[model samples]
Target: MPIDHKQTYDGNNIFARIVRGEIPSKKVLETEHSLAFHDINPLAAIHVLVIPKGPYVSWEDFSANASDAEIADFVRAVGETARIVGAEPQGYRLLANTGKRAGQEVAHLHVHIFGGQPLGGMLAR
Candidate 1:
């Protein structure tokens, strides 16, 4: 289920906790503005979640509030994480679900990197 993009950032969300060093995650890469970690429940062989270190509820929020440096760092972090996870050679899908219909379970903005095998159609038929 997706969450309200306008909702205030939850400091206790799993990603937030992970960023704050309260929850443990299989970290892939950590930069000043972003953190990339393997998803606990992966849908693909190389599923990872790249999230900004700042408190943001959704992509819109992040885009509207995050600094230019933060945004640039986050973007680079996603690409770096994908390369580090060996997904570049095989191609990968970058997904950032926003709004209620997109199935964004977590309130925090995260870009999912899915790859390592044929992903088939972009959406189920």
Candidate 2:
């Protein structure tokens, strides 16, 4: 446990609260290691967040030590989330902001699934 997992998220971390059942979410899909739900602040017609259940601060942290099973679970959750957002048979953008510089406001590791229309190019400066 190199990083302080407890400090990774405070009580205000909405995803953490959702996972803990402290708050209700439009849960679209889930697995032993991952959970998917609609984004409260949606950027597109269909925007969802796919998050891992482990104590992870960001994508870099999760990818660095995620087991094969954990990685598979995350990816499967992403796929399921895409389907839930109607991004499957069509397409979508998957976003995982790694750090502050990348616009990751939440410490909990999550992948954003957004689509249902012509999305913007990318994160602009």
Candidate 3:
């Protein structure tokens, strides 16, 4: 686990504010429980991040308190975004970096959905 496991950062804590027009973002999709936006620095042709509208700094924070319904809603939103982004049939990669060692930079819990091209090689890099 990350050293900052005890710390909790809600969507409204920062980034979500940007998405909600409280700040600003290169936004994409928004739902009641989740939000999607293009990665500021993308690693793939279609790199969008799907994040829950909750106060969870990382997956640990979310998993510890989030309900099954919250989890389901997040997945469903990702699936819907995938279809909308044309990564449905071809599929995509959903990446959740749990900690700094795992390459989670932003601190907020988010799943990166990317594909529409070769992904296997990208993972090894």
Candidate 4:
């Protein structure tokens, strides 16, 4: 189900469970403020999801509530995850779906790194 950006953060969400070690994920990178892992249902050849450690429902919630250090660390973690996945060489796309309209399936703030081949257009026509 798509998440509502205005809704409160759900601690029991999938990403939260993964963070708590209750759910297993093929981890790609782990930082003080973020966690990167391979997406189980990958959209591309190289698809990864980077999520903040904090309880943020969306990017707006994260930007408004997270500490500066946490924000920086999360951003760096995403970049480092891309580099570690070897997606930086071919360039990549970072996507964060904020609401149901945008197809945000998780109630946690996560950035999807998509690459490893020609991605074509920004959106399907």
Candidate 5:
């Protein structure tokens, strides 16, 4: 999907405020490249959001602009966050909503981690 760059990373979005420490969040993990926090509204017993520290509209933006080390660190944070939440043993779902069609409400690039039960499927077979 083609992302609307104008709508991608709005500084007023909640994520941006959280990243700037302007707003409070139930933070779970923070690394040099990423920040992991409990979603204010969770879809599962264990739902967290892992986002890059820098301004990024979507995964494509991050992948295209960030350095190799930054990308690696961000990905590492997601895995580390899952372990902290104890979702590793039972398995978890890591999802990224890219564009409007994918249901990306927030413009900033973030990965949603959900678990605590069998999530079944999101697509029709």
Candidate 6:
């Protein structure tokens, strides 16, 4: 157990709350290992957040601790979310902010699927 692991995987995060059914979210896709839902503050025409059911704070934690089956299920859920949100036709961007500098607000590990229109360039410019 490392300090980063301890700091990153704070189980009481907002997404963790959502995973625990403590916070209501408009779900787009749900599997046994993951949950995909609409973002509260959407940045694109279609913005969905795909999160693993397990407690994790970043992609590193997920890759390090999750089984191959869990990872596959979670990744597949992202694609399913994109299709349900109508991002599968044109194009989509998957975003996972790992740390504070990257604007990762929630401590729970999640991927943001954005599409349905021209997202333009990156870095929020």
Highest-lDDT candidate: 4
Residue ranges of candidate 5 with Cα displaced over 4 Å = 1-8
Each model's lDDT: 0.94, 0.81, 0.78, 0.95, 0.89, 0.86
lDDT of 6 by residue, 1-125 (tens): 11233364676778888988999999988899999999999988898999999987789888999999899999889888888889999999999987766777777888999998898887775
Stretches of candidate 2 above 4 Å error?
Answer: 1-12
lDDT of 5 by residue, 10-55 (tens): 8877888999999999999998889999999898999999999988
Decide which is better by lDDT, 1 or 6: 1
Candidate 6 RMSD to the correct structure: 3.4
How does candidate 6 fare on TM-score? 0.90
Candidate 6 Cα outliers beyond 4 Å, as residue runs: 1-8
Error of 5 at 96 (Å): 0.3
Query: lDDT tens string, model 3, 1-125?
Result: 34354555645555567556796666677877788888788988989888887777788888878888888888888988888888878879998887767777666788889988878754565
The reply for model 3, stretches above 4 Å from the true place, is: 1-3, 10-14, 121-125
> Which is better, 4 or 5, measured by TM-score?
4
Work out the TM-score per prediction. 0.97, 0.86, 0.82, 0.97, 0.91, 0.90
User: Which of 3 and 6 is ahead in lDDT?
Assistant: 6
What are the clashing pairs of model 5? none
Q: List the residue pairs that clash in candidate 3.
A: 10-55
What ranking of all candidate models by TM-score puts the best one first? Answer: 4, 1, 5, 6, 2, 3
Evaluation by lDDT, superior candidate among 4 and 5: 4
Candidate 6 lDDT at 109 equals 85
- Measured over all alpha carbons after superposition, the RMSD of each candidate to the real structure, in angstroms, is 0.8, 4.0, 2.8, 0.7, 2.5, 3.4
